[model samples]
Target: MSDQRESIRSNAKYLRNVRPIDPEEICEYVAGNPHPAVVRQQLREEAADLRLIEQDDGTFVPADDEPVSPRRGPVERFPAEYERRLEDLLVERYGPNWEDGASGDLLRSTVRRFKADYLDGRPVEYNDDVAAGYAIYHLPGYYAAIQYALDDLADRGLLDRTLRVLDLGAGVGGPALGLCDYLPDDALLEYHAVEPSAAADVLKDLLAETGRNTHPTIHRTTAEAFDPSEAVSGDGSSDGFDPTAPDDGFDLVLACNVLSELDDPVDVMQSYLETLAPKGTFLAMAPADKNTSVQLREVERELEEERLWDRDAVDFETSAAGDAERYRRGEVTVYGPTVRLWPGETPSDRGWSFDVRPDLDVPAVQRRLDENAPDDGEHAPGEFVNVDVQFSYSQLRLDGRRRIDMALETNEWAKMAEMERHVTERIDLVAAKLSRSLSGGDGNGGRGSGRSNPLFKISDGSEDTDHYAVVTTETALNRPLLEAGYGDVCSFEGILALWNDDEEAYNLVVDEETIVDRIT
Candidate 1:
């Protein structure tokens, strides 16, 4: 190992140009079964701070994009202190009338009502006093969701410029606050916020918390009612309705957590997309509920047909499958014209549950709980309810759209899948049943007759990867094929319908019956 290290010490110059070093592929230069120590030694010799980052899949990859220093963990921290101050102000606002001690139960109930109103897409007529309290309760979770969304945007090269942001229905400016935290110290940002709620009253105060880092302008109007032509374009000056005018549109448009509440959300989204400056992004996010997520998907679908934007979902899905399924790859600007849940975020049986910390301090609630104290003295008041949040988000843009006259060539799999889904045309792809080992079912291509839904993996003719899909068929549909088919499993080679899946693999349905010639 030492000899190899000495031999490759000259190679350190080449390694310096490679920022992120994949730990897996680091051994090509060394001779005959080089021990892992030699690789480590070479990496250290090249760059001392280079570290192996464990990905979500538990594999180590070089942290090339922006490597963290040493073992200090993620550079981003939740803005807990900034948020805590706002909660303190909420309690202070009600302190004057609390001499007799507040009702912890009432405040808790009010907070719960605030949350329910948000998810149910209903008006929050809970009064100004409770509105402030609700912000105190929900801001952390809102910040978390917006932070994750903005983090994703930042990673996609969308935030590379000095950001000019327009946040619609900006709830107390949470997305603006999250954006402020995401940018660099010297990175200038101009933020414009549109919100008609009483929550808008405090958005300036919250933006001020960023302390000299951001410039915020609050537009006090409902999104649908807000007119972009009349909007001040953040340059401290007014401009007429010229699209080519300076300071015309936003680089980042945020319709965060408020899409479902708008009167005409699709129309509002169309308006928002128009206000996007060239090379701009529009993001729409909602609570991680089934309805809101589904609505966002519908919005994504509608946007594809709109003339303003070229869709990115197809390229997004194709790249995810990488080059092996490059045949399935679509143009970077084209999409399925359909919006599905982002991968791994499919609503589970328990529904859209996101992580939250009920552990944050709630002094007023605590006082009320303390006053109403039981003799047993266990459990925090807010802990018994849902306080944390998860959400679904859709990020789209207008920069990549193919012009109206241009033709869109569909990929083979997408075409075949579409044929199966719509035309009811049968197509052939090599498919294997999803082994029942994961779901505790017998892998006999089981459906009904005391079996789980039939799931399968279709090969893409790629050795290292396979596409997993599921098809819904009754025992009757697959039974005939099986009689001609299996020694142990039902393997089919032709005429299957494309069903839903994680995009890497899918669920495909077989025809009612087939002659068994393609079985393996």
Candidate 2:
């Protein structure tokens, strides 16, 4: 092993610069290997200073002397059934005093905001392509674990029959809608989405327009304050909740990308896990971020005490590199895009495939060339490649029209276009070898050229290297590809497009393991 270390380091570039990793490929990697030493090291480094904050709800908040402002709102005036449950939640959490006029007005306003922003007609500014794209782009890889775990449950006949699904912190309803798209039409799914933001309204309207509202129940309630009873009427049935069917506890509970936000995710999960029926599936997904790691650890700890269902590691889905970076930076303002779960075994199900158009998915690869290089304005210190996941493969024939329509309604397309351009410009750099080869000029200047490949250089704030990386003799190549497939696969051709093709420079690497470790 020691002998192989030198080779691993020497040939790391060659080994790392592999093609895009598939969902199945990642599944196989986890299936084959246990946690690696580096992973443990990274986890420790990432978690070293971690201190568990004993939140009122039992979820650990990061140690911050600055108090987390209490979430304030009026008592919601949902339909009678939803109202009753909302009242019960108010009493249980905030004490009975929270059920009156001012509180009701506050809740009403918040719900109205949720309906307006996320329902069908309201509006808020969450439609930024960079934000949405970042979320959509990376969610699949992490979603893949949920898919695999759900499939395993289905294979076990656990998800058979019409199942009720509840998506907590359902951001733009990505996983909720993604699951809706993934499930069979006749699957008899009663989707009850709990999103407290205006974005929830946008998602609600989206589902309704797409005819997915046939059996949907949307509540503009935060996960902490969201009342399941509100989703299920007093008589244990769904009312104006779109589906308007019986509102028993959900058969499958999906909390994706939101756990990291809770003061006590376990308390939140515990609050809902009991709502699941025997043999029910509880799935949670989160970015393979520090918050997720802590949340998962906490959940595992809690489950150990409960002696509930077993857990199996699964594949890592894909999403935007920038989004993942935001998560690492704890800058992702929303959740639900990443997922975490309980009760569900490692899912083996192949979730929905991306259906973005080919042209849209395949962006032009650009290399920011150094003017003084062998080839003026030709050689770059680095390369930037973008793959439009939505455009990559539309085999599923998804009507991005609805999403696009929503995008247009939100008017985020222009912003998305601008973001794409901005990202491209940011990642464009001088490829060390390309600059050297360019200094040799055209094909006429062969080897033995005096020019040298540039080493690491800082990126202008304009680009988000959240996706790109530096390659050197000891640089690991596959890391990026791992990231790409996990979110957006950067093709070899895309790399070549940015290369000078002169010097022996390191190509991109897709480290599926590392990528999976981040968002799953």
TM-score leader: 1
lDDT (Cα) of model 2 = 0.35
Candidate 1 structure quality by residue, lDDT tens digits, 191-306: 67888777886676677677332556788888888766554533233535342233456777888877777777888888678677766667777765557766775676566456
* lDDT of each residue in 1-520, candidate 2, tens digit only: 2333322222222322453212222222443432344322222221211221222322222233331121122211112322233234344543564423454334333433433443342333443222222222233333233443344344334454355677888765546544654454334455678877655644554465332213566887789997676765322333344321223446677777666567787778766765654435566654432334335534533532343221121234467653221111101111111111211211111121111112222111111111112333533442122222221110000111110111121121112112334332322221111111122222212223443331221111122121123322222432332232212212221221122234332223212212212211
| Candidate 1, pairs of clashing residues | 310-401, 467-505, 468-505, 468-506, 469-506, 469-507, 470-506, 470-507, 470-508
Which runs in model 2 stand beyond 4 Å of their true positions? 1-145, 209-214, 233-247, 307-520
Q: lDDT at 435 for candidate 1?
A: 25
lDDT of each: 0.49, 0.35
Q: Give Cα distance to truth, residue 151, candidate 2, Å.
A: 1.8
